[model samples]
Target: MRIARWTVTDLIHDGFVIDDRVVEFPDGLTVADVLARGLSATGELYERVRDAAATPLADIRLLAPLVPAAVRDFVAFEEHVEGVSAGVEGKSDVAPEWYEAPTFYFTNPHTILGPDEPVSPPVTERLDFELELAAVIGAAPGVGQANLTAGDAASVIFGYTIMNDWSARDLQGREMKVRLGPAKGKDFGMSLGPWIVTADELAPYLDADGFLAVRAEVYVNDELVGEDLVSNMGWPFPELVAYASRNSCVVPGDVLGSGTVGNGGCLGELWGRNGSLTPPPLQTGDIVRMVVEGVGELVGAVGAHVAAPQLPRARTRTRARRR
Candidate 1:
C-alpha cells in the first residue's frame, strides 16, 4: 500500500494513494499516528480506508509524508564514494576502513520539502541533486530483537520513498576540505515524496541476492542525467539500518537514505566524466526529478539562488606554506 499526506483545501490530511485517488483517513490521522503503532499495524488501517471515497490525485497538493523523528543518510554505495573522492580530492581509492562499516550522517529534518515544491539553493550555481531511496524506520518498541541485527532489518523497516538530497557543490567542497562538515552545503532542503510504499508492497521485486532490484534515475529539465540500479550498493539497507541502530535506537518516522547511486548520479560525478568541458550545474528554473522504480518520483524546481552573506573570520587568508 502507498501512504501519502496532502492538502485538499486549507486542511492537510494523511491517506492512502490508491490508483490516482487519495483515500483519506476519516479523522485527522497522520503518518506519525500510524507509525507509532509500527508498520505491522498498517494492515488494519489499510482495511479501514481501502474502500472509502477518495479525492482525485490532481485535486490535492502533496506534502512531505511526515515530520520525521530523525533522518540519517547513509553512504552505502562504494562507487559513489570512490567517484566523489576522486572528483573532489583527486583521490581515486576508497579508504580501507570505509568498506568495513556503513557510514552516515544526520541531516536537517526541518528543511524537508515535498514533490513539486521549489528549492532555493544556497548559491545560484553549482547546485546538484542526489537520487536516493529512503527507508522509514518502524516503531522500535518490540520486534523480538533488542540489539537489532542486520538480519532483523526487515522487521523494522516500514516503507520507502524517493529522495533528492540537494547540494551546493561549492559550499560542500569548501567545508568538507576542512574535515568538518557538509553542513550548510547540504541542509538547505531535501525533496521526499510522491508517497511512501510499504515494504510488503515491494516484496515481489526482491532479488535473489537479497537486494531490491530497483532502477534509479535522475532527470534535470526533462533531460536524463543519471541512472543506476539500487543493487550496486555494496551494503544493503538492512546492514545500514542495523549499524545505525547499534548501541542506540531507531524509532518510528526515522528515515535513512541510501546515498547517491553510481554511473553519474549527480553533476559532481557527471562533470568529472570529462576533463574540462562539462554541462552546467543546476540554476534557477531547473527541474530535478528523481525516480526509484518501486518508490515513485520526486520533482522540484530550483527556485532562486540565495544571496550569500559574509563569512565570520579574523583573517581573510590562511598562513602560507613553508618554503
Candidate 2:
C-alpha cells in the first residue's frame, strides 16, 4: 500500500510499490482518488496492478506522491519549539496557548521540489535544512471540499512522506523581527517525496495503541547533521490538521507538514545562540539526504543556476485603452 506517482516510458501514472515490484494504478491517480473508492477498492487496485508485471523500481522516476491542491506546515513538535525557543530572544517554556491550539503556516504548493532535483539557494546565504513529515490528504467528505474535523483529517490522510523545509536563516530572522511568521525565508525551496507510504500499509509501524514511531534523521553530504524522535511532537498530526481545517477547508492531495523535527533539525535554530556553527552550506556538488523510519529517503544534489539575461523594463501605461 505504498502509493506513489512516477514516470516510466515518458508517461506518468499512479502506482503502488509491492516488494520490489512496480504496479500501475488508473490514470490521473491520486491518493484521494484511491481512498474514496474505500479499502476494498484499494486492495483490489493493488491486486490488479501487481498482477500485470513487475518492474524494477529504480527504472522509474518518482514524483511527489500527490499533486496537492494546497500545502501547510504546522509547528507541532515540542522539542523543536523548545530548542528554537531557547535560542530566541527571551522565550523558554512552551507557550500556554500552543498546548491548547495548533499553529501552521501556508506554504506555496508550487515551490515543492521532487526527489533528486537540484535546489538552488535563495538570495540569502544562510541556507539551512529542516527534517519533517508531511501528511498527504487522501479523500474525505466535506473536508476536501468544505468543512473538516480531526477524524476527517485522519480519513483524508492517504499516507505520509518525508519533508525538507529548506530555510534562509538570515531572511527568516529579518522577517520575523517584524513579528510575522516566515515568508521569503521559506517558500523558495522545499522538498518532499521519493514516494508516499499509505497509512494502512504503514500500520505495522504504527504502535499497538495506534501511534507512529518513526525516527527522523537528516544528512548533508553524507555527514549526519540532525536526529530526532517523531514522538517528541507536542501536538499530534491529526490535531494539527483538524485545527488547521476548523474554518478553512482542506482538500484531497493537500499536504500538511510537521514543521521541523527537534535538535539538529536546523543550523540556525541549533547554533544561532550557542555561538557555534554547522557544516558548510550545500554547494553545487553537495547532496542532501533525509530519512524517516517508515517512509523512504529523499536524495537531492545541489546544481548550478545559470543567470538569465536581463530584460528591458516596460514603460508604465496610464492612458485609458481605446475600444
Best by TM-score: 1
Summarize candidate 2's per-residue lDDT along 148-237 as a digit string, tens digits.
566666676677888888877777878899899698788777888978887776667665444567888888888888888776777667
The RMSD (Cα, Å) of candidate 2 is 4.6
Instruction: Report the Cα lDDT for residue 291, model 2.
Output: 88
lDDT per model vs. reference: 0.83, 0.75
Candidate 1 collision pairs? none
Model 2: per-residue Cα lDDT at residue 222:
89
Write the residue-wise lDDT of candidate 1 on 1-323 in tens digits: 89899987669889899898999865677888887777767778888878998889999999998788888988888878777776676765688988888889999999999989999887635788888988987764444344588877767888999888999888888888898878999999988898889988887777887788899999988988888999888787878888887778788898999988987787777666543326688888888888889788899999978787877786676677975
Per-model C-alpha RMSD = 3.9, 4.6
lDDT of 2 at 320: 78
Summed backbone clashes in each candidate are: 0, 3
Instruction: Report the error of model 1 at residue 83, Å.
Output: 1.8
TM-score for all models, in order of appearance:
0.93, 0.85
